[model samples]
Target: MDASLEPRLDFVTCASPAGLHRMAYWEWGDPANDRVLLCVHGLTRTGRDFDTLARRLAGRYRVVCPDVVGRGRSDWLVNPAFYTVPQYVSDMVTLIARLRPGSLAWVGTSMGGLIGMALSGAGAFAKAMLAMRPHAGMLPPDQGIRLDKLVLNDVGPRLENGALSRIGQYVGDSSEFASFQDAVAAMRANSQTFGPHTDAQWADLAKYLYPEQGGKWVKHYDVAISQALSSQTAEELAAGEQILWRSYDAIDCPVLIVRGAQSDLLTRATVDEMLKRNPRARAHEVAGVGHAPTLIADDQVNPVADFLLA
Candidate 1:
C-alpha cells in the first residue's frame, strides 16, 4: 500500500452460493473514515480498473474496489450459469457484511451498476449510488425512475448491436494489445472520456492482463463470463431485462445517470421515458464516444468523484 494513500490494501474472500472465492480489493484513505466509496467495474473488467479513480479519491474517502467474482483474482463460480447479477449480488452482499457499517457510496459501471441497484432496492447496501453507463431496470414489475443527481453513463433500455460489438474488442480480447500502451491507446480511441493516461494508470491495468500460450494478452477473468453472454437465448435475455426493470423502480437512494452521447447501448427514447416517470432524475451526455465512458481520464473521474463526494 502507498503510505500517501491512507487506507491500507486488504485481501478477503467471501463464500457465496457459488463457492468460496478470493476478492482482492484496494482500500485507500483512512480506514476509520466513515465516508466509504465502492467502485465496481463493468463486465469483463477487474477491480484494478478503478486504480486511477481510487488513487484520486484516496485522500477524502475510504475507497473500496472489489474484484467481482469470476474476474481478476476472484474465484470462478462453480456453475458458470450463476454468472449473472443475482450471483454477483450475493457475493457483494457477503463482502459488505465483512466490511461492516452496511452503507457506502457506490460507483458502478455496466453490470456493476445493476448489482448496485439490486442491493439498493433491497435496502442492503450503500447510502448513495452513482451508476456509470448503468443498465436500466432490474425487475419487470418495477418502472425505471429518474432521481435527482443521478448519472447514467451511455446506457439505456436498448443498445445498438453494432456499437456493442465494437466495444467488445477492448473488453473481450486483450490479446490484441502487445503492451499496456496498446491497451491504453485502444481505450482512448474508443473511450468517451477524452484524455491522456499517466504511466500509473497504464501500469494498473497492466497487472490485470496476463500473457496466454500464444504470447497474446488476456484479461484475468473467467472465460465463462463471455460464455454466459453467448449462451443466453433472446427470450431469456428479455426476461432478465424485465426482472431488472422491476428492480430499478425500487431504488430509493440518490441517483446520478451519465450517458455517453455516442453510446449505442443507452437509447434516447429510454432516457426520455425514464425522465418522464422519475422527473427527479437528471441526465448528461458525453460527446464523441460510444457504448461506455471509462472513468480513467480526468474528464470522467472528476464528474464521478464530484457526484459521489457531493
Candidate 2:
C-alpha cells in the first residue's frame, strides 16, 4: 500500500424517479487530470474495492471509484425498483457530465460491468439524460459520453442463473455480526468465488463491506436491492439480455474481458461469443480463481495496468 495514496472522499447527487440521492466516490490522483478512469465495484461491494488498481494507474489517469447508490456511503433508493441498471446508467451520465473528462475509460466488475455495457450504447439517450442537470451543458450533446476503452471484469451480456441464485442466497441477508472479524469471516464465506486473498487483503475489502448500525456490523448496501433482484421475471431478464447483447455489439472502443478460469458467472462460451461478436475485444483469464479476479494480486493487477496503459 502506498502510504501517500489515500483517496479523497467525494459525493455527487443523482436523480431518481422517486427523488434524488447522493452517491459517494473516492477520487484519486490529480483532480485536474482530464483523462479519467471510472472504476465501479460489484454488487454488495463499495468503491474501496479498486484501491489497489486505482493507485497503480493514478499518475497516468484521474481515477474515480464510486460506491454506487444503495451501497457504501451513498444514499439508498426510496424505492428498490430504482436499483436497476438504467438508473445507474443515468446517474453515471450525470457524473460523466460533471467530470467532463477529455478521455474516459471504464473498469466495471459484475453489476458494474453490465452498467458499463449499457452506457457504452446509450449515446442516443444522452440528450435526454443531460437534461436532468442544467449545468451539465459542459459536455457537448453530440459526443455523448463515449468511452475510449472498457474493461469488463468477470461479467458479460449473459449471466448464469445458478451463479445469480448463489448470490441471491445472501444478497439481502440481514444477519449482523458481533465483531468486525466475524463479519469479515461471514463475507469471505459467501465470497469464496472471489478466489484466495491474503488475510490482510480480506480485511481490506471487508472494511468497506459493512458499517456499524445499531452498534452491530451490518451489510453496507440497502437490503431492498435484493427485492429488485428477486422481483425480475424471466421475461424481464430475457428482454434485458437482448438489450445488453445489442449494446455489446455496438461498442466501437477497445475492450478487455477478464475472467476467472473457474468462474461460474462468466463462462468460456460467453467469452468466445463476445470475441466473435466484437473484433476489438480480447480476453484474459486468471488461473485458480472463480467468479472474479480481485485485481489485487500482482498477476491480476499487471494485466489490467498494461491493458489500460496500452
Candidate topping TM-score: 2
Which candidate gets the maximum lDDT versus the true structure? Answer: 2
Off by over 4 Å in 2: 1-3, 123-144
lDDT of 1: 0.61
Residues 167-206, candidate 2: write the lDDT tens digits.
9889978899999999999989988988889899999989
**10 residues in a row with least lDDT, candidate 2:** 135-144
lDDT of 1 by residue, 1-310 (tens): 3645433456677654446767777677777776677778777677777777788877777778888878776777777766766566656666666676334777777777777666555432211111311432122112222222234455543444555565555554534656656655554455533234466754554557553435655557776666666665666556555555544555566666767666567766777766665645566666665556777777777878787767
Q: How many clashing residue pairs, candidate 2? A: 0
Q: How does candidate 2 fare on TM-score?
A: 0.93
Q: lDDT scores for all predictions?
A: 0.61, 0.87
